[model samples]
Target: MTAALPRADVAPVAPAKRRRHALGWLAVVPLLVFTAIAFGLPALAVLDGAFTAKDPATGATSYTTGNLTTSLQGPYLTALLGSVKLSAVSAALGALLGLPLAQAVVGSRSRALREAVLTASGVLANFGGVPLAFAFVATLGNAGVLTVRLGLKDSGWDLYSFWGLVLVYLYFLIPLMVLTITPALEGLRSQWREAALNNGATGAQYWRHVALHVLAPSLLGGLVLLFGSAFAAYATAAAMVGSAVPLVTLQIADALSGNVLVGQENVALALSLDMVLVAGLVMAVYLPLQRRSARWLDA
Candidate 1:
């Protein structure tokens, strides 16, 4: 017998799938356009300015690495280091506090409690920028009501310093972490706990030996989110402390606004590039961990 001919349905399957995939991408065309316009264009502009140097007298433009070199030298490097330090510490503390709080909320039987906590977290997480700065300044800054009444300033509490910024950052960062890890906390299957208990494991043992292993990726991902959130923070830091703290965001602002040094705008752009690279690194680590967590959680 001659070799059987392929069925009509089978022959058309690949093209039909390709068409569906094309339609899927087409559906997201608007979003892709928006992203290009909003993010991609600005990024390109920053990248160009970061490497382009302008001559003052001749009004000439040329590509150079001087801006990048300047950004990595002197106080700029200090500010970058300070920003990384602040983001790391804030993210760590936020994760520590948020994970437990999320766990408590998730483990509770009261749906109302869980709803209330999540609602509050969602609000507080977004409650940053200038308004947040003002709130903290009023509550903890020098001559603040609480500061005076509670004698916190006399106790050496300064809300315009590095540690103080860390505290302010934590206000929102903790809530953000809670929101991020809540789903991961919920993704934790009850069966795992049951199985652990059935195997004569204690609560702490179950977590240390079983639950923590599974939650590790999600936890790290949430920490990355918090780090990025804090790293890119500007308004709150700028308003609260100005240049009192050596933060890269403040350095960028000062450079752009000519508040620190005039005609260092290119350096500001280079700093922006640096921040972008750091953020890219954070995302690279986060995306893979998130994918792994999702796979395990879904399975």
Candidate 2:
């Protein structure tokens, strides 16, 4: 070599680089181990159990698709359709309501009001299941505040109906959409609006041309999130309607219990079928959304 490298510099550099890599890998170790033990094992177990049938006599296991077919019959099919309709409506309503709320909050001049609105939205976003159900009961249920104050003894306000469920779902979905969409709203350059105004663009024209384009991704993404949330919901339905509503989640829960007439094998198969359907729905919606988002990014 023309000149020898300094030992102190080279030695320290190599060790330091190695140490950094080791630390980086170390940070991921806990997550990797936790995923393998907790999530991976449980999922595999469910899959294996779903496909195998246990003999009620000798406890022998064998493969069968009888339970899977039974799950596809009328009752489960009806529940699936109902769940889809309810969730779709909820997500749509959430986006419609949320977009304006987010706009208002983002457009505010006062910092205190903005912070207060954001804080309230965040609280409501996490406020679903039992607490939300109770809140609704207090507001709109029998002997509720509205009921008593309006003297609507026979107001025909039944919270056990399908529309009632949609209303409850929206209570949670709106806040979530606001939380998700607000970031994208914030990321939008203010100059775009100012530029449009400078060019003699009216309010409607500016919103149509500039604001809508920027917000489309966040809006659709928010709808997808709301759909998944309402689709997979169990607690709200259980607390509110119980078995009377006949939602998929409630049906799945019923099948899993010991009281079901179809037995555990059938229950397992039904659960697997339900899971596959839900997973398929999510992928069907999510793949197109991802592609759209990517297109927007490219543009």
Candidate 3:
């Protein structure tokens, strides 16, 4: 007998699947191209420049680790540390304030109240940058309405100070914390509490053993997000504090513009690389915890 031929249907099935796969990929092409142009290419350029140094006299370029080393020294190091400190402090503060607010919102009896808070949080979380700076300045600055009326400047309060920056940061940070942690808070089931109570467990015991334990991962994830947000923020800080603050973002801007020190463009790129690494590390820690938290929350 002749060798059995593959079924006609089977022969077309492979090509059909291949065509479907190609079409699926075609749908993603626009996104991939956009990412490459907006993020990938710029990131590659930063990475390339961070490792390359140019000679002023010869106008020649060479690869070196000098930029990385320079980034870790003196003012650069200080700015990096400051950025870390600011991010950590602001994140902590946001968590402290937001946890209670989120719990309040989640526990509220009225659906309207919950929706209102969430809607407000969403708006306020994105209400940063120059307009936010202007609003704060108008409300709390030296000549601001509140400051002028309260005479707070005479009380040794300056809106341009570090603590002032923290206060301004809180305006958005708290709302961000609320938006992130609200869903996690809502994930907590009433049955868990009832079960604990039926088992003769106190409220404190339930929270200590069950609630907090389950919520810990999500809380940490929210903090990580807030930290990253604070760390990468540039416009608000730029508008509110200008060069008065020694932030890494400001230093990067100064270096890139050749305003603070000329020939430090590579150093700025190195700083940018440093920021990417920091943000990457935060997300690295966040993602696994977020995944673990989601498992329980979704259940």
Candidate 4:
């Protein structure tokens, strides 16, 4: 009876699974660290500074809402509104142009054509900031080659004006819209189209009822993304128009760099907070639309 003691059996743990999980976490660590360093800390600093004011004489920091109040008044408000209008207009124009371009590429029978369009889009979407500003200036400025050749200056076309900025913004915005909406366009199911046709729906009716309905979410999301991109853009406008344009980004730079009124750095932080809020709101709207788009597109 004593020799009949039972031995308990235990399953062996999978070392490979544990190792793979560890590697996955390890791979993510760098990205996590980078995000915290690049975005998280700066955001925190800005938030903190937005609600706190510093005394120039004593260099003492105190909690106050003056920065926020100041940001929403006068020139700051005007700059904010200008930025909003510019972003909205540019995004709308991008959507108008990009949708047709995306459709053209998607509907094309040639794979090479599709690839070429996509490649061009990828390049142009990122063709922004200083280099883009330089390109536009060299091509469209008062003494630009084309401007001189075509006598565009005589037509009162100034490349440093509000409308000019919109055109420059569209260079990047249109391509971004194309890239964003192309996937949604491709996700349109052929069977759905066939079904609509079989049900005696004309092409226009099919688009109005089925295709547009399905594509609306993606389109709206892409527009929101473009809006945010245009809203936050700085370098292009700065390089092209300098302080000629009263953009929020320009104001922020002025405040931070002491190029405008000195000791208004806190105001810059407040401006940044406003920009973040606007961007956050855009993303909030975009996320739900993107989710809805994915529900049908990924199906």
Candidate 4 residue 276 C-alpha distance from true site, Å: 0.7
Model 4 stretches with alpha carbons more than 4 Å out: 1-27
Give the number of the best model, judged by TM-score: 1
Question: Once superposed on the true structure, which residue ranges of model 1 sit more than 4 Å away at CA?
Answer: 1-15
Q: Could you estimate the TM-score for every candidate? A: 0.95, 0.85, 0.92, 0.91
* Model 3 per-residue lDDT at 233: 94
The lDDT of model 4 is 0.95
What is residue 4's positional error in candidate 3, in angstroms?
Answer: 16
- What's the residue-level lDDT of 297 in candidate 2? 47
Q: Rank the candidates by TM-score, best first.
A: 1, 3, 4, 2
lDDT of 4 by residue, 1-299 (tens): 55864444423346667889999999999999999999999999999999999888998989999999999999999999999999999999999999999999999999999999999999999888999999999999999999999999998999999999999999999999999999999999999999999999999999999999999999999999999999999999999999777899999999999987988999999999999999999999999999999998888
What tens-digit string does per-residue lDDT give for candidate 3 at 1-299? Answer: 89998887778888899999999999999999999999999999999999999999999999999999999999999999989999999999999999999999999999999999999999999889999999999999999999999999999989897889999999999999999999898899999999999999999999899999999999999999999999999999999999777799999999999997899999999999999999999999999999999999888
Candidate 2 RMSD to the correct structure: 3.4
- What digit string (tens of lDDT, one per residue) describes model 1 on residues 56-94? 999999999999999999999999999999999999999
* CA displacement after TM-score superposition, residue 58 of candidate 1 (Å): 1.2
Q: Candidate 2, TM-score vs. the true structure? A: 0.85
- Clash number for every model? 0, 0, 0, 0
Query: Pairs clashing in candidate 3?
Result: none
For candidate 3, what is the TM-score?
A: 0.92
lDDT tens per residue, model 2, 168-210: 9888889888888887777777678899999999989999988
Model 2's number of clashes is 0
Q: How accurate locally, in lDDT, is each candidate? A: 0.95, 0.79, 0.95, 0.95
